[model samples]
Target: MLHALINGLGLGLLLAIAVGPIIFSIIKISLGYGKKAGYAFITGVCLCDALLILLGNVAAEVMRSALEYKNLIGIIGGCLFIIMGIYSFFFGKKPDFEKSRDIQVDYRKRDMAKFTLQGFFINLFNPGPLLFWLTTCTTYSFLNTNERILLFSTTLAVVFLTDFLKVNLAQKIKRWLTPPNLAKLHKATALILTLCGVIIASSVILKNFISW
Candidate 1:
């Protein structure tokens, strides 16, 4: 259990540090509509992650078998990251803080639900999370079922807590997140994501094709 907790924490931190569209969206929503909206979005992302974890457990053997093709998966995931990074960098809309603040003044239950659903679909359509969960499960296949559960639960808890902190921090510093600053942040995120994709793809190629 202790080992599981530690490993889960490590995995959770890795995820929390990884900048992607979801994190971008969470921060944007938090800055715009407040922490509640951010929480709603994170909840949706967590639920989707939970579903992927469940599926990985139920189909553990299949997932393990699939690992034989990890190079291919890496390639696909890398391409996806590159595409997402490019789109976000070039075409992402600037969040209108004034407009969002107006909406928040009259925020409703249905609006929360809509945000939740937005988070859900955004995460659901992203191949990254599914691939990540699958890879984690396969990598830790030595662990028994109970240990896996412990690790997964701890991981999820840490991720949610970390994301909550991020949202709160963003809300607190939102005044500094002017349009120009946000645009710079968006471009930075895009560069990081694209670089990650390139690295992943290159590592696979070097390992499989390169002699040394």
Candidate 2:
């Protein structure tokens, strides 16, 4: 049990440092929206992780079969990223974070729900997390059922805690950001997102072509 907890901590920390769309989106949402929005977003993300873990453990065979269509998944994920990137780049609403601190903006529940769903799908379509959980489940299959449960629960908790820290940090950093700087940051994040999308989609397509 102790061993499983430690291993789970290591895995969670490893994932926390991983540079991906999820992290960027969290930071962006936190900086642009608010802590509540960030919380909602991470809620969706954590839920997705939990779901993937569950599927990885309970349906390893099914997941293996699903991997056969990974190319399609990659394409869809990539396109989603690309579209999000474009939207963020051009049409993303720039809220006045400085003013938001003093003002009680009535952020709608509908918006929160939308952000939550966005987080869920974005994490879902990302191949890295899916493959990761799948591999982790297979590698740790030696653990007893209780150990497995404890391990994953610990991992999920760590992930959520780390993400919560990130949200707070991003929020703090927003105070120092000027409008021009914020705009530049948004554009940079958008470009990175688009690049990530393109790479994911293109890599799969290229791999398929090479195999033929």
Candidate 3:
């Protein structure tokens, strides 16, 4: 159990540091809306992770088979990322902090719900997380059922805790997140998404065409 907990903590730390669209979104929400919004977003992501863990445990064989078609998953995920990146780059609305202050009491619930759903869908459609869970579950298949459960639960707890910390940190630095800086961040994210898409597509092409 101790070993599992330690391993889980390591995995959680790795997740915390992993750079992706979700991380950017979390920081953006934290800096824009507040810690509550960030918590809502993280909740959605954690729920998805929980669901994936459950599915992997219950349908291990199915997941194993699914992994064989990872390229297809990658293509779909890549396209989604590219589209989101474009939208963020071109049409992303800067959070109106002043306006939010004016109506914060009125719209708090609605905005929290919206941000929660946004986080859920974004993480759900991301192939990276899917593949990550699949691979990790498979790799640790040697462990007993109880041990696996312990590890997974612990890891998820750590992830949520770390995410909460990140939200607080982003909130602390919110002053630096000006409109121009946010725009630049969006552009950089867009480039990363497009590049990821091209890489996934290229991998499929090369796998099919290149012999050597």
Candidate 4:
């Protein structure tokens, strides 16, 4: 159990550092709506992680088979990525973050439910996230049933902590960076995400048919 918890913590930390749409969404929520929305976004991601964990546990075989169709999942994930990238790339109509301090929102409080649901869908549609959990979380052996549950709990704990910390830290660092630098960062994040989608697609496609 200790080993599983430690391994999960490491995986959670590394994944938290990934700069992608999810991270960008966290930043946008923070800058546009403040800490409440930012936290909402993080909560949504944690929920998504929990859902994947549950799904992997109950439907491991189905998920395993589905994720193994690398090219198919890749194509879908890639299309979503390319589309999101284009949208963000041409998202000139949206308010720039630097000028968003005065934007007024009318909700009594930010609807965390909405944020969470949207975040959940984004994760679900992406495919790779589920694939990752199915492969990484359940692929190995544990010493006992208690150990497995402990590992899942530890993974969730690490996920919540690391994700919240990253969102807050990125927003904190935003103040020091110039507009151009930030724009570049957003673009870079988009590219990396798109690349991940592509890699998943290529790997699966190759594995599905081409490897000798």
Best by lDDT: 2
Give per-model CA RMSD: 6.2, 9.9, 8.5, 7.9
Q: Candidate 1 residues 59-141, lDDT tens each?
A: 66564467767677667656766776677678856545444432223457567887777778888888778866765665455
Candidate 3 lDDT by residue in tens digits, 1-212: 78667767766865765545666677777767778988998999999889887776665554346766655654554565556556655875644333333212223656677777777878889876886676556545445677888899988998899888879888554565566765566567556655555655566567767765
Q: Sort all candidates by lDDT, best to worst.
A: 2, 1, 3, 4
Model 4, CA-based lDDT: 0.61
Top candidate when judged by TM-score against the true structure: 1
Q: Please report the TM-score between candidate 1 and the true structure.
A: 0.61
Candidate 3, number of clashes: 0
What tens digits encode model 2's per-residue C-alpha lDDT throughout 1-212?
99789868866875675545676677778777878999998999999999999888885444345765656765775777677678768986653444433312345756788778777988999876896677666545546678888889989999999999989998555454667866776677667667767876797799889999
User: How much lDDT does each candidate structure score?
Assistant: 0.73, 0.74, 0.68, 0.61
Error of 1 at 9 (Å): 0.6
TM-score of each: 0.61, 0.59, 0.59, 0.58
Q: How many backbone clashes does candidate 1 have?
A: 0
lDDT winner between 2 and 3, please give it. Answer: 2
Q: List the residue pairs that clash in candidate 4.
A: 70-204
Candidate 3: C-alpha RMSD after superposition: 8.5
Look at candidate 3 and tell me the lDDT of residue 147. Answer: 80
Q: What is candidate 4's lDDT per residue for 113-149, written digit by digit as tens?
A: 7766666777777665776666544443212456657
The residue ranges of model 3 lying beyond 4 angstroms of the native Cα positions read 61-108, 171-212
- Clash totals for all models, in order? 0, 0, 0, 1
